[model samples]
Target: MVDNPKESAGRCAQVAGWLTAACQAGHTLLSEPEAKAVLQAYGIPIVETRIALTEDEAVQQAEQLGSPVVLKLLSPTITHKSRMGGVRLVLRTAEEVRQAYRAVAEAAERQAGAGQMQGVTVQPMVTLEGYKLIVGSFCDPQFGPVLLFGSGGRLVEVRRDTALALPPLTTTLARRLLERTRIFTALQHGAAGLPAVDLAALERLLVRFSLLIVEQPLIRECDINPVLAAGDHLLALDARIVLHSIDVPEIALPRLAIRPYPSHYLEN
Candidate 1:
């Protein structure tokens, strides 16, 4: 997104530090909030999330954000929160927030045992008016960076509607990736009285996704699912980032099966 050099450098340091810390701790999976931080720093829009360490704190945070926010258990050991009943949605009042907090607390305890339970994450509940799409990439042992885009949300695995493209995507390349998907037709034309989503916005995110993978090879894999594409808005509702181990130095680029198109040579 054309950030200045200073901003870019700060982002580099922050992301590198997070990756390093996680690898040093012998962890590959970053918590949702942690992954969102990396995405936000890279200019990808995400719902700002806050952590509540206690029941009262959860209620207060929920009240401040107003009614109908979401509360999910936060734990380094638990990633599939929904599967573990650690997610509470559409909570409307202080009492509801308190109850939800306790519910997720129990869930976390059950999943991770006693002292392993962490706090809960609080984020405003945003309505899904348009398509919930997934934008992500992985370091392919052969192709280097491979980008992915498709239907997200609960139907992700069941539907299996997705497309892949090599990294360093231009607007044209991004559009081509989207077109390969089955839902792209419906996304382009109004379907079942629903209007088409903003293709330009999705294309922009796709391009940014490619650049993110290009610049930050430490990100071994990433998934920004349910990126709510309502009108012109593209906010990542949830993200998961997996980092390369510390054995792979952040400065060294992973060997790619194919040499990337050297666009930098055109500049200087």
Candidate 2:
């Protein structure tokens, strides 16, 4: 859950400072864990992941996350994971996770090139009976911050069921944005015998995500793909944030079209 707006603002400021340091150090993308941390701070539900340096460590992490886990090769150089065959899903046992760890690591090294391989990450498999959605935000050269929603998954590129809105969205506006998308139509009317998806929960998630962008101006782009929606639950399966290397002036309000996160309340 999210804290009070003031506290949330403080946390976002803290995260932005850390990311700015990374940007200064020549990092453009936040690693999975770092992205999840930002999302967690904003009260988004994300898949828990742990870095495993070895096969034994991978098995241990899988055990810790519980059975039916997933293994992915974590690397700075490997941007498109599925294309490189760097992802393994549905490892139900420790041995299976161990084997998957080695395979994914080796493949990542081969595909991503030497010295580009980081350790593998262990994540619990998320099984949902509802739609997979995408939620994201980006800085437009002309429009400042823009929020996006759509159908998402392995074939998201092909489907292209997306809608866009400006940041600092109200609940009503966010709902309208969702309603504009084709997936939202399916979600509203029910799909494949599944009951109508939880629009209220999804709306709340989108609103929070918008506020997160308003709070953190350094974020150039963010992707929360396959936001699993089943019944009244929504979970972020995979996420990433891209940072820009521009210096931000310390002002009361950021230079955004929308009202940025209110940091003034933090003093009180």
Give the 10-residue window scoring lowest on summed lDDT in candidate 1.
Answer: 259-268
Q: What tens digits encode model 1's per-residue C-alpha lDDT throughout 182-224? A: 9898788857666888898888888877777877777888988
lDDT of each residue in 122-228, candidate 2, tens digit only: 89898768788899888777788788999998888999899999888877888999989888778888988877888888888988898888878778889998788
User: What stretches of model 1 exceed 4 Å from their correct place?
Assistant: 1-10, 25-27, 249-253, 257-268
The list of candidate 2 runs beyond 4 A from truth reads: 1-5, 246-255, 260-268
RMSD of each: 2.5, 3.2
On a 0 to 100 scale, what is the lDDT of residue 177 in model 1? 94
lDDT of 1 at 32: 83
Query: How accurate locally is residue 24 in candidate 2, as Cα lDDT from 0 to 100?
Result: 85
TM-score of each: 0.89, 0.90
